[model samples]
Target: MEERYALLLERLTKTEPEFQKAYRDSLDMSWIYHDSALEGSVYTAQELKAAMDPTAPIVTDSSIQPICEEIRRHREALEYIRDFADKKRQPLNIDVVKKIYLILHPEEGDIKTVKYRKDIPQHRLYFHEYAPPDKITYKVRQVLDWVNDPETRRTRSTIRIAARAHYDLLRVFPFASDSGKVARLFMNLLLLRGGYPPAIVHSTERQRYYEALKGSSATMTQIVHESIENNLGSVEKLLEGHESKGYAVKV
Candidate 1:
């Protein structure tokens, strides 16, 4: 899987800058849509467009305001992680995780004041068992430390590290709400930091995702691998289309 991904990345790097940017623009919407859907929030096509495109006219309907706001906040969170990945200097830390949650839920206020759940709700639906309230902070810190360990980073495939990180963090279920979303974002943040594309766990695969969480990180690893391969295939097809149209394409 790593070998195939390396080759794909090499090929993708040769594409025109404009083409790459356009592809990323399309990806941003899909990423937002699927991530939101995983949290049981679905956005209409028009709503997604309005939320993502800065040039789109302002939305005026009162009823749709909250949906649009949530979508926009999700987009902002995505951008934040992407930018952090590009910089490649900031180590994955607890503060960074808190900041991401804050970005997704700005109404919650300052990062320093962010708190983990003190009690698990019996009524809420959860895919997997969570760490006890007392263990949340310890488990979260451990996961981050493991992810940032130099030996782990040097020896493990990025996909494995990312998958395990996502799995382990979600197992802890650190936050009261949006823990799943934050875990997904942190997974992509690690992927981007490692020079890989973000893995979109599509809404269609929601059942599989939950099931995988119940088992091992290997299943999640395969899901991420396939998602990236699918993305590479899309880029390959686009470049092939350009070539067929008599436009120059790098080999």
Candidate 2:
């Protein structure tokens, strides 16, 4: 995994110019997508045009602050993830995963809704609806047990657990807001703390994003591969032509 990260970083740095250019362009596109996602709808062509207006900043201070704050909280969350990853004797059970998500989105501590889904056999599915606190706690626990079980100890199995941590939690809308981002980070963190460099889903690719997540029964390979490809592509582009100006990824 460390080697994988190194290889990815090298590829990205080599393509700095093209990578950075694509990154900038994609960020512009992501702003539009973010705005629409925030509004809970895909953008109309006009709305996308409006989003790209020169005078209109793509991200507002309100949204920006939360992102930065999340990053800060992320630093703290990583500590717990490190501890959990090292505890190989115990598979991460539900209580533990929820605790991580709570650390990431503390504000979601109080949201409640009465809805549920049992589609995923091993998971306490909430089926595209807000889950009540009690129900969420129950399902998360079930997920943890499945992950920790010795039978599911393979890399692919762990990856499947990580993917469920996203699909189930996000689809359930466990948090009042930022559930998607938080969930994405949570699953990736599980991978990262376990030695993976972390898979990143760039906000720019909507078709790929939804399609990657659209199946009635989504799998970890689908989402993980999407993220890996996106991350590799981004890093490769960044390294090709962009001037680092002394900025480098922290070791």
Candidate 3:
């Protein structure tokens, strides 16, 4: 599996600039849609295109305005993480995680004042267990420490580390809302830093995802591995199509 992933990355480097942009654009839309869907927020295909595509016609429906804004914020948060992954040399920290949360909810206030859920309401339903309010801070710090530890990075596979980080954060459920999404974003950030593509755990796998969370990070790691493999296959097909069109293959 690792060999296949490495070969796929090598092939991807030979893709044309236009194809690369189109592929990334498509992946970004799918990434946003599936991630939101996993949390039970469904956006229609038309709505997603309208929000994500600058060339698409402007949306004027009053009812859809909030949806569009939410999509925009999520995209901004995605872009922020991508940039951070590319340029930032420092290890992942609490502040960076808080910044991601703040980007997703600017209305919530500044990063300095970012706060976790004081208490989860008993009336509310959640798909997985979360740390109690009193344990949120300590659990979050532990996750950061584990991910940032030099020995952890040196010994563990990137996928395993990323999956464990995601599971740990979701278990902590630091924020009252969007904690799942933030956990995913952080996971992808780690993957990108390790030269792997983002693992877009599709909404189709929602039940499997929840169940994995209920168990251990090992299950989550397998899900991530499969997600990466799926993405690599998708890109491989795209490259094949490009080659069939009489483009000179570099690889």
Candidate 4:
């Protein structure tokens, strides 16, 4: 897995400007599609790409408009998160995460997200429960602090750190909605800052994904680490094919 990460970094260095942009687009759209899936979005990659376009004809079916708007907001949120890739930016801070929460939900009328919710919404995953609303702020801050802890940084692999942060945030359940989305983005922010490609948890793995969360943090971390490693392996093969100028993934 580390080898693949190194190869990916190397391949990135060798890419032409065109390949770089295409690769970034591939990563961004993939993240958006799968993260949206985790949050009950039904849009496919093609539908998401179309909806993200400014010039694409708007769909008039009001029934689907909600989904379309959801995709639109997600794309905006993802873009906002991506900007944190800058080395000068702090990616995992409370302010940054709150900004992400705001971006994911833009229809709050005049309500800015100032504090954690007092509502204890039930999870679709059986046996899943969130932190108490009163303790939400403290729990979230603990996770954020852990992400920045020097000892934690010195000991854990980037994958483990990301997985831990993701799992811990879910345990905290910071926002009223889109908590999973925020958690995944938070994990990827760590990965990207550490020079790793973002991880993808497919909708098809919904059961396993949730099950991991339900089990233990170690199990969940392994699941996330393996998912990221596998995705990087796929990227490596794709890059090799691109280097050979033969068609790789049609995606």
- Counting clashing residue pairs in each candidate, in order, gives 0, 21, 0, 0
**What Cα-based lDDT does every candidate model obtain?**
0.84, 0.54, 0.87, 0.76
Across 1-251, the per-residue lDDT of candidate 2 in tens digits comes to 45666776555555436555565445435433453353244544434433444454454557454544444455456556656666766655555655666776666462332222323323322224455555765665555566566676664554566777666666555544445655665676577655565555544544555554555436545756666656556555555445445545434
The candidate scoring highest on TM-score is 3
Worst 10 residues of 2 by lDDT: 118-127
Task: List model 3 lDDT by residue over 19-103, tens digit each.
Answer: 7788778888889999999989999988888888899888999888889888989999889888988875776899888989998
After superposition, the stretches of candidate 1 with alpha carbons farther than 4 Å from their true spots are 1-21, 247-251
RMSD of each: 2.4, 8.5, 2.0, 3.7
RMSD of 3: 2.0
Q: Could you tell me the TM-score of candidate 4?
A: 0.85
Q: Which window of 10 residues has the lowest lDDT sum in candidate 1?
A: 1-10
When summed lDDT is taken over every stretch of 10 residues in candidate 3, the lowest stretch is 121-130
- By lDDT: ranked, best first: 3, 1, 4, 2
* lDDT tens digits, residue span 1-251, model 4: 65668767776767777787777667767777777776666677657666666667787767767777777777777777667865645546788778777777765432353667777876544246678888987888899899889999999898889989999888778777888888888887787777777778877777788887777889878778777877887787878888788543322
Q: Pick by lDDT: which candidate is best?
A: 3
Runs of candidate 2 with Cα error greater than 4 angstroms are: 1-3, 6-71, 74-91, 105-134, 155-158, 207-214, 236-251
TM-score per prediction, in order, is 0.89, 0.54, 0.92, 0.85
